[model samples]
Target chain A: MGSFVQWLIESMFLWKALIIIVIFAITLAIAAYSTWGERKVAAYIQDRRGPNRAGWGGLLQPLADAGKMFFKEDFIPAQADKWLFILGPCLSMFTALMSSAVVPFGSSFIIGGKEVFVQAIEINIGILYVFGVVSLGVYGVMIGGWASNNKFSLLGAIRAASQNISYELAMGMSIIAILMMSGTLSVREIVLQQHGGNWNIFYQPLGFLIFTICAFAECNRTPFDLPECETELVGGYHTEYSSMKLGFYLFAEYINMFASSAVTACLFFGGYNYPGMDFVERQLISGFGANAGHNVATLIGIGSMFTKILFGIFFFMWVRWTVPRFRYDQLMNLGWKGLIPLAVGNLIITAVAILSGYKLVGIWVGLALMVILISIVWSLRPKKKNAIMGA
Target chain B: MQNILNLPPIWYTFAILSVLTLFGALGTIMSKNPVHSVIYLIVTFFSISAHYILLNAQFLAAVNIIVYAGAIMVLFLFVIMFLNMKEEADEMKNNKLVTAAIVTALLLGGILIIFLRRAGKEKVDALGFNSQTGMVEILGQSLYGEYLLPFELISVLFLVAMAGAVMLAKREQGERHF
Candidate 1:
């Protein structure tokens, strides 16, 4: 076993290819299952038994959905851009799955006497890669809508594009605060930084709040989901899409949502680090020695990371259920008139604090100033004192 | 070549990342609608960030993504979406111009290839670089020490953008109050 593993690594082509294929498969599989889970979640939320007919508590629902979609008649509206119509869902799904490539699921462990990192690809700029992929995420919507040749679909896509672009300000600025404190953007480094209860939540609570809110906006989830408001947009950008193509769009969204949630957890909340994570690592390491046997330890790390991500996803779902969708104007105002300025202020405070010797004071003073300013602005709004002449 | 292969798989991931970026740029142009073009532009900026990561310039990559893809492109997309112009091909009647556009694009590609060919390539040697190098510390040191003026300038630029956005979005100055 040891010899064969060494041989595989040395071969380079074979092992890396195998690794790539495995990661690809796992990512798609996870995405597919999440679709099923989402349906079950929606059903349960709506007080209905969901898809229990398909393979024991609806375990096979995704499969059934896939089958139906594939065999369903695919149609393209005559007025649509045929090529772009085809490209839309493909682009969306591709970008969504590509993001998983850089996420570090676990630390390196010895397998068959060869040390290997658990992540599919350990790009130092993993965080950036995720960002880039996510930015491209909007393309799927844009193309699909444009190709649909429908005014409503196009309007929906336009709204989505604008909303994402707006909220991304707060999102980017907030991450900068984390980047300043953690001093690293690499997810692995971010995770390792939490060796002994150094989770970012303790240090940068405000930034975490900003990121979580923006993540919802970015995912088009909940109150921020004006782009796809069923009452207004009638299925929005995916309105003209049908068959597997439509499934692809929805599937891409859930996967992207899950992945984004994972990223949020990994960055601000300590990716896989838990309360007693170190103790578990120590005991496992002492028992197996990093080289002798360490799969269990790595698995533990992966599980912990997933737990954090699951919590983040649940948070997303909870918000989706709880919050009412915002008006379009309100959404835009939050992004531009609200979050952008706050993010900019946060960036300045973070930069100043990190540079100067007064980190704690910088944060507190910044937050206080912002609050006071907001309150002042709110109160100063010209309230119409109406003693209407109608009497 | 042997030594290069010995580098991690991520070493070649750069090639893939770069290709995705190029695709983004191409996608932008192929998209007739300016809104779609802008979305692709955002993707292009992001892919550039990915390139920064591959080069181990992690800090720059993050900042790049945040500034270009996040802030700048958002503003651009907003403006484009507001305008809502139908896909107008001023060149739609001119079949001759399509060939011109294609030829010019190809020429640009050829020039880039020539530039690449002119540069002598070297083998990978790790050279004191690693995953840890692209973190907050080095980024801060570089930004404050060397890139300080530019950093300050970004604030000015942002202020400019704010003024510009307000002016653009505002109703004509001698008009009715809201």
Candidate 2:
């Protein structure tokens, strides 16, 4: 026990442990409040006053929500497997939190004469790690739905599993383009490579579009939320769940949205990087001390990263409210036929451009090709049958 | 007692992983429910992936989780759920079948033990833990350079299998479209 404590102290494990707790708590808090945010966003979109009765701007609404969940009776269906019934939500929350371990939130800051990276863990294969954990998110839904012992729940789970499988392919292909361009799998390395004004969105715009659409599908957001569409499945996978277990499933969705948004910001946007920040840091250092300048830069970087994440979340909500849910077949069709081919084409173009040393021109060429392909698909779509309409 | 305390961490990890892997594999066949069996199989895969991580095969560990536990096992569960195989059908257990199962299991175990013993004899000098072994760059180099022909052939084989599956699953013109 003494030796173990000594090793822990020598490795500075306490700092990392503290960071993990902070990140996990912040993630859960954001996920909880996102429900309120969603409701407010929906109300604003519909031109109505939103939740404001709890506290100032309904800031205390999430607390009230949690209180209600805790007070509600925890339930398990009579015929359900009790253990798996409980394991579902736990798995959901676990996988949702696992993906954030490798995400870099800000630039390195000096503390006690040592540089500290603003990530829970700096794994070598950061992008792959995220993909692996996110892919496991399907199990929570599948197990939960199956254990519910309801036909609707089982159907919803099956649909979710297949949807995840379909979309992950395109998402992975889109990321492959960025991987080729960045030439690294580490999220921190990707962000550092995109420092200043060299965000990947500029170079891989088509890939970013494909990735964003796939991200929406993977998160079960609007246009791909057939699994839980209220009109069809009636709460879908969580139809039989009640109390905190139900809360866990819903909270997991918001957490997934948050994590995927952070990942998108890190991959496509400049993660924790702002234009002219280096110059600002240099001037600040010349005027003040080195540590103060670095602290300022790191603070601004963290703020910028959070801003990007919040905006991404808002965009997800906005799209959810605006666009209607897709038909199940249409969702699959879009994933397999539309996004996969586009991602493959984008990847090929990116590779060719890299090979030919015309990287900037390559993006433009990719855009042109996508536009042409869209037009071709649009024109080739079968026209409505006039005779049936007339009859 | 001192040696036990001084033992490296990976040995403990390996012990735990081996136990978990064995339990999962046994549970997979012992479970009555097909869904439970698939879940057990997933557990087995996870323990194996953990073992890979302990061996510093990070790439293999991630791929193992993503492809096997995440994708393939999910599909297995989906099929079982779709077919609504909630409980296993009761069949008469013959003594012959039971004996055959036991003999087959023992034979497999024996083969595994033989391989394990031979592995110790033919063991190459094990390299110390190095970050380079797990990086994508080195893995890619070996895969593309030393194993390129086998890799391409395996991909082609997968392509053929995919085409075969598609051909077998396609509906005929007379069939009702879902």
Candidate 3:
């Protein structure tokens, strides 16, 4: 027991534990409030005043929403599998929350002459850890759909399962290009490598594009949200769910969005690395001494990281509202035929470029390849029948 | 009490995980519903992955969950759901089949026991248990260096299997050959 306590103290300081709890709470709060953000964004886009009744500009809207969910009568279908019906949302929320553990929000800062890494956990295989959990999240959708005992729900769940699995291949392949360039799997290491404005986006812009698109598909966002298309499958897998159980599914999606955005920022954009950060750091160190300046720099990094995450979320919302959902066939074709082949080609080009010691040229090559591929896909795409000249 | 307290946390975790894995495996075999069986199998895989974590094989642990619990079990669930399998009735019991099952179980147990006995005779890897063993870099180096041929061969095997699966699933134009 003493040894365990000693180990815990050594491995995780009181400050670290507090930071983790704070981050966890913040993540949940963000996910809860993101619903409000989404509605507000949608309303703004559609030209309306969105939910301003709960508080000043609907600041307390999420709380009211939570309360409503709590007060609402919970309903379960008569033929539903009780165990799996409950397990579904719990699994979704659990996996969604777990994926955030690997993300590095900021660089290390000195506290009591010891360096503290500002993230929940530091694992060597951080990227893979997130991928594994995200992949596991599909089970929640599958189980929920199956347990619902509704045909629509079942179809939606199967579609979601296949969709997530298919997109994950492209996502993983695209990430391979980033991994090759960064030469590390640890999220912190990747972020650190991107310090002083050497963000991975510059080197692997094409990879980033592929990753972002695949992320949308993986998250079941925007044009890729065929699984739960309201015009077809009514509420999709959550058709039978009511009250907090339903809330959990929605909340899980938001959390997944937040986590994936953070992951993208960490992978592509400079995670916490701001441009001219070294110059600022040096100036600050000379002006205000080392430790204090370092603390300030760390704060700035955290701020920058959050900014990137917010923008990423905004991009998700913007795309969601702007782009119409793809047909089911188009979704599969884009994933399997479009992204996978492009990702593989990009990865091969990256490898060859690395081998030949022409890393900068590799980025241009990747961009050219992506453009060519897109054009090829565009030309080959089955043309939509003209409305005036009926097919 | 002092000795119990002095034991490392990993031992306690290992004991709990081992028991859980065994229970999950039993449930997998004993569950009447195919979906329930698949879920139990997933639980078993998860516990085994927990064991992998305890052994400091973090990469293996993650891969195990991703491959077994995530992908493979999902496919299993999909199949069971697609079939819409219900609880099976006890029928078509044959003496020969029962005898064959018993013999197979006995043989498997004997082989497992022999392997365990042989393993027990060797020195433990405790002295060589470096935390870095599980890092992606080390794993990649070893896999690409010493295990390159085997890895390539396995990838080729997977490609073949995938092609076979695609072919099997493909619809035939000429008379719908089974």
Candidate 4:
């Protein structure tokens, strides 16, 4: 069996296809289980016993959930756009899967006297591929909302559109800070940029904060889940959907969660890097077995990345349970009135810093500007006496 | 079969693209509804974009999808839903619409066939793009360097569109007062 595996690895085309399939399966499976994890996290946070009955510590809960969703009845409302209703989820799932194509899982390792890379597909516009894919995520919600033949669904879709559009601006702007610091848009390059103790969180702490907040808003997690506000919209855009159709929406959300977490890990948390990673590999592992176990080092890099992603996922769940959901108007107000201006300011600061060669001073100045802006916003708010009188 | 699959990359892509193009254009017209038409148009755009990707004109394809499908189709859907014009009216001259669509389809198909025939005579590119990069850097460099005028013009065009939309949606004060 080991020899067969070795032979399979030696064949390039066969190995490529196998690797692609494995990556797809692993990503999708992680996304699937994240849904169960989210529920368990929420339950634990709320002081309730979680899904312990499915398997040992509810290890098989996600499988049971998938089974339940599959067995449930599928329905198409008489007035719904049947074609679009189908197309919506397909778009969501397709775009959700597309962005992972360019991410480098690990550094290259030697195979058959030649170096072999572990990335799925290396493209020059790696990050732009992500931008494109993320933009397409909007279509799923928009189409699903429009096809539901219900007012609530339409409203939910509209909210999703407006919220996404608003946040994408800030999100893009937040990215400018990273792009300036890293000097490249390639995810692998960005990871390489943070190879040491100099993770981007040190250089661009405010940018990290802004980007993390924007990530929440972009993924439509609480306190930004205005699109799926249960109290007002009655299940929001998926109100009329049942069975796998409903499962598709929920599944897409989880995939989106994973994807966003992956992006966050890549951008702010040094991607697949840890402090002293190279030092440890060079000093200790390089000598072991005449460096024959190089794959082990690569494995460590890959595992570090996945660990960061897992932490990101946990953070998403933690925030979801801890923070109350934003009201619709407040969501809009925060997105447009607050984040947009701040993002634009952040972009200007980043640009000026890059061009002016005032690395430390420029950043501190930017931070001060951000503080002033926030203080101005606070000062502009109505006093309690005036607010009470007006009310 | 293996040899066919292993054909030179350009020709392989070209053959598949031609088939997809034919199917897409055919499906666009043959479809009964505007929704279907738009969806088919998206597929057509995507196939064309893939062809662009093959040719290493990645920028053009990205713009093609972003402008035509992403921006334009959404507006089309908005208008259709707003007007609630989901289906053709029974009282309408169905033959007229059908004939008009058919004639246009035929004319387009004929032109494309002629173009394909001519293109077949030209030297096929067996190699050119070796390293693939996203179009953004290339497009950005070109736009700011050689194509600066056109880039500025596009910005102006966007501004004009914004102004036009505002003007069209605006409530006339004269009418309101009256």
Candidate 5:
């Protein structure tokens, strides 16, 4: 029994399990704080003080909200499909948590003379894994909405399904450009490739733009949040949900926001990779021993990763407050007509650049040509007459 | 008995997944609600994807989930949800159609059993097995290098189908087709 216990303690699986739990807790904590952060950002944007009476600058607001959600009556509609209605939120939360498994939060730490990766699992098909999980996220909204037996909920669910499907095309296309350049799908390899300020965003700016827009649509954030537009669909898919079930749906959104932000940071913003990273590592190694220095550097990388993620989250909130919600037609048009075409164009240009071995210069030249073409088209277009003013 | 007791952990996983796949398939056909059936179908897809993973074909597993369970099943559920299907609608009203279905099922099962029996009798050459063939790099190389023509042709076929769909869905200026 003692030998078995020792083996258990020494096993890599035990450490990996602990790391998974830690990352899971961190994700939930960040998601909780994001709710508070959203309110503060919104309040500041609207020129009002947010919930400051709860704790120091409303630090404890999310906990208070959670408590309120827990204490509230867990209401289920009489006509609702009981099992599916419950499964909806659970599925949503599960998928949201699952997508974060592949994101390399930092570099590896050396413990017991062994390299412990900061990521939960480093699978070769990391990007595809995230996409697969995210695509399943729609079911939560769909099931919840359909099971509610409400017309409004059904509409919201339909909107979500269509929106996710439409945006996912553009998103996949955009990511293809990156994959073509990197020639790998593993998120860690992609991040490592972007070391020392050599980020993919430099080469794939247009792709990044398309990807970020699609990400917004996928997350159902403001400017693309037609699924839950209260003016039209009440609370949308979660209209019939109450108490913790409703809390789960809302918490899932925040978690999705956090996860997507982390992904964006990793994909475009050089996740966990900062300029002078090598220099800092060297300095730390000189100061401390190799293992300790490497561990410290990994911590710094983790800090940099969190900084980028927080900034991405802030950007999400900023856009939410500043941008007006898009009309449903406009949202669909942007996704299908606008972003898809642009993504395809960007992809073609990237392919040409890669083929011709011009790489950086070719991409810039392609961008210039595209800009020139767009300007010429804009100048040559027939002007519309203002029917209302007769101008 | 000794071999069974000392079997590898992967065998246990395979057994569980096989059971799940069968259970999901049964649930899909046996479920009363159309939505429930769709959910069960998704479960079956997931178990199949897991089987692909166990075979070390991670790319196939991911694509299976993304395409079948993620996209296709969502569409299935979407259509089913909007259908307003009554419980009575699930009943087989046509005896002739039911008989045809059963006959076809029996024929397919017989063929599958015959194929399985024949295949099982053949000796396996495990030495030639290359597990690395399923990795992304090797798979990509084979798809693009060896099977490029067929891949491109299939993509072209998909493009044509998409165009046909769009043309069929398009409406004339004055027509109220709906």
Candidate 6:
């Protein structure tokens, strides 16, 4: 029995299980707080005092919201496909949770003479895994909308499917530049490559912009939240959803926001890689012993990662409140015409830069050329005279 | 009991996945609703991806899920939903068509079995397998270095297909836009 206990303690799988649980809990906590944060941000932006009555500046508001959601009536439409209706939110929540598995939350720590990574799993094809999971996320919304047997819900689902498919192309193309630069698909390697402020954002600003926009579209956040646009498609895809089912759908969105922010930070903004990380690591090592210092440094990295992710969440909310949602045709035009061509151009520039062994110079020059070309096209374009203004 | 317990975990995983794959395939064909059929097909795709992962082909697994289960299946669901196919009206009522389908299915199954049997005759050293062969780095190296032409050709083919689709979908002058 003692030996079995010892073995369990020493087992890698056991440690991994513990780490997974911790990460899952942390993800849920963050997602819950993000709802509160969104409300606060929205209120502040609109010049209102948001939910301060709840524990300490609305800290416990998410809990109250969850409780209320739980107590609400769980209504399934008479015509709704019951199983698929339930499966919709489950799949959404599942995919949203699964995408975070490969994200390296921080550097590894020395634990029990073993190097324990902060990430849940470190797959070689991390980016593709995330992409696959994200792609699967559409089914949740699609299935829910369809099963609702409502015209407005069907419209919302159709809009979501097309939007996701369109933006995914540009998103994949934009990431190719980063893949070329990093030369690895693993999120850990990508983060490590961007150590000490040598971030991808500096070199691939245009690609980052495209990626960020695609990320917004992918998460179905504002400007791209056409799927749930309250103005037109009343309640949109989740029009028929009620109680905990609706809660699950809403919770999944927050989780997706958190996961995408983490991915963006890791890919471009130098995830967990603060400017003085190396210096701090060195100082800690000198002060404390090696293992302890390394562990502390890992903790600090985790802190930095969370900070960036929170800022990303804040940015999401900021844009949500600030930008007006695009018209359907305008959204399609921006995705297909604007982003795709730009991403392809960026890809070509990246390929050329890498081939010539002058990545920085080549990219900047290419960007300049693109800007000039755009300006020329803008100048040559036909302008319509406004009848009202008599231009 | 000891012998059963001593079997590698992969064997158990393979068994479960094989069962899932078969179940999903059967469900796809048998389900009444087209949307349900699509969902079942997605399940089959996911199981196939798991099989790929079991073979240590992580990249292929990811791509399989991303392409088949993700994009293609979503499109399938979208079309099925848009058509609002809730009835059994589309089901084949002709006995001739049923007989033809059965014959085709049987013939395909027979051919697949023959091929599998022939392939199984070749010796495989599971212990000596090079795990690195399935890694993305090696896959990339071979794709660009050795099979570059075929890769480019495939991409060009896709581009042509995309252009054909666009051309087919394009609105002619004086046509109703909707």
Q: True interface contacts reproduced by each model, as a fraction?
A: 0.23, 0.83, 0.73, 0.03, 0.83, 0.97
Q: Select the stronger candidate by lDDT from 1 and 2.
A: 2
lDDT of 4 at A87: 77
Which 10 consecutive residues of model 3 chain A have the lowest summed lDDT?
A382-391
The residue-level lDDT of candidate 6 at B170 comes to 90
lDDT of 1 by residue, A206-274 (tens): 788888888888788888877678899898988999999998888887887778877877787777667
Tens digit per residue, CA lDDT, model 5, A305-390: 99999998899999999999988877887888889988998999999999999999999899889889988987898887764333
- Per-prediction DockQ comes to 0.28, 0.83, 0.74, 0.25, 0.85, 0.90
Candidate 4 per-residue C-alpha lDDT over A93-132 given as tens digits, one digit per residue, 9 for 90 to 100: 7877877777777776656665666677776667766766
lDDT by residue for model 3 (B49-90), tens: 988888788889989988888788888888888899775755
Question: What tier of docking accuracy does candidate 6 attain?
Answer: high
Tell me each candidate's TM-score.
0.78, 0.94, 0.93, 0.83, 0.95, 0.96
Write the residue-wise lDDT of candidate 2 on A270-359 in tens digits.
999988989988987887689878877788899999899999999999999999888787788788888998888888888988998989
Task: Report the poorest 10 consecutive residues by lDDT, candidate 2 chain B.
Answer: B85-94
Question: In model 1, which regions exceed 4 Å deviation?
Answer: A1-8, A11-23, A289-293, A348-391, B1-143, B154-158, B172-178
Instruction: Please state the CAPRI-style docking class of candidate 2.
Output: high
iRMSD, all candidates: 2.9, 0.7, 0.9, 2.5, 0.6, 0.6
Between candidates 1 and 3, the TM-score winner: 3
What order do you get sorting by DockQ, best first?
Answer: 6, 5, 2, 3, 1, 4
RMSD of 6: 2.2
* Model 2 ranges off by over 4 Å: A1-9, A373-391, B90-114, B127-131
**Better DockQ candidate (1, 3):** 3
Alpha-carbon DockQ of candidate 5: 0.85
The sequence of per-residue lDDT tens digits that candidate 4 reaches over residues B1-178 is: 8988778878977998979988989999888776567667777888998888887876677667655665566556555544656666673468888888889999999999999999989865558643444466766776789999988999999999988987997688776632
Report the TM-score of candidate 2, chain B only.
0.82
